[model samples]
Target: MPRLFQVIGRQEPVATVSMTVYLHATSADYAAVGDDYLLVDSRGARGGRGFYDQHATIWSRDGRLLVTTQQVVWYRVTK
Candidate 1:
């Protein structure tokens, strides 16, 4: 089984952006009975002039990696 996620809220304008994501588990990982799991997100930003990059990773309670993601955004400057 596959899960779907939706985000609903106010919309904001953004410049050019790129992103990559890796999901490292199947439904079985989530459907297991009597199993407790943990999720963690790590993020960072670098650069100036409204340009930055960020990354995040999700791990289980036992330090098993579940998912990883990265994204970059930058604005165009006009002279």
Candidate 2:
């Protein structure tokens, strides 16, 4: 599986992040991609206090994006 990273926030004029994601072949005869976290417990990845923004979204590999919801608190995708 290719490595992936996800930043939780809205698209800003200035990118304030350090992460990247990779893509792999799917057996379904199609291409696909998504975000990843080093640990299931993402709060460990944050050095300081954690934060969450309802208006925030995510960017995946190939510069694709996944829409977000203000009422939604967390999002997860798996293959």
Say what the RMSD of model 2 is. 15.0
State the lDDT of candidate 2 residue by residue for 1-79, as single tens digits.
Answer: 1112345333222222333333333433122432342112122222222222223344444444433223212223232
Clashing pairs in 2: none
- The runs of at least 3 residues in candidate 1 whose Cα sits more than 4 Å from the true structure, single-residue gaps closed, are 1-16, 33-37, 75-79
> Which candidate ranks first by TM-score, i.e. highest?
1
- TM-score computed on alpha carbons, candidate 2: 0.25
Clashing pairs in 1: none
Q: Rate the local accuracy (lDDT) of all candidates.
A: 0.59, 0.30
lDDT of 1 by residue, 8-79 (tens): 133333454788989887767645422676776755557556566768887777676777988776644342
| Clash numbers, per candidate | 0, 0
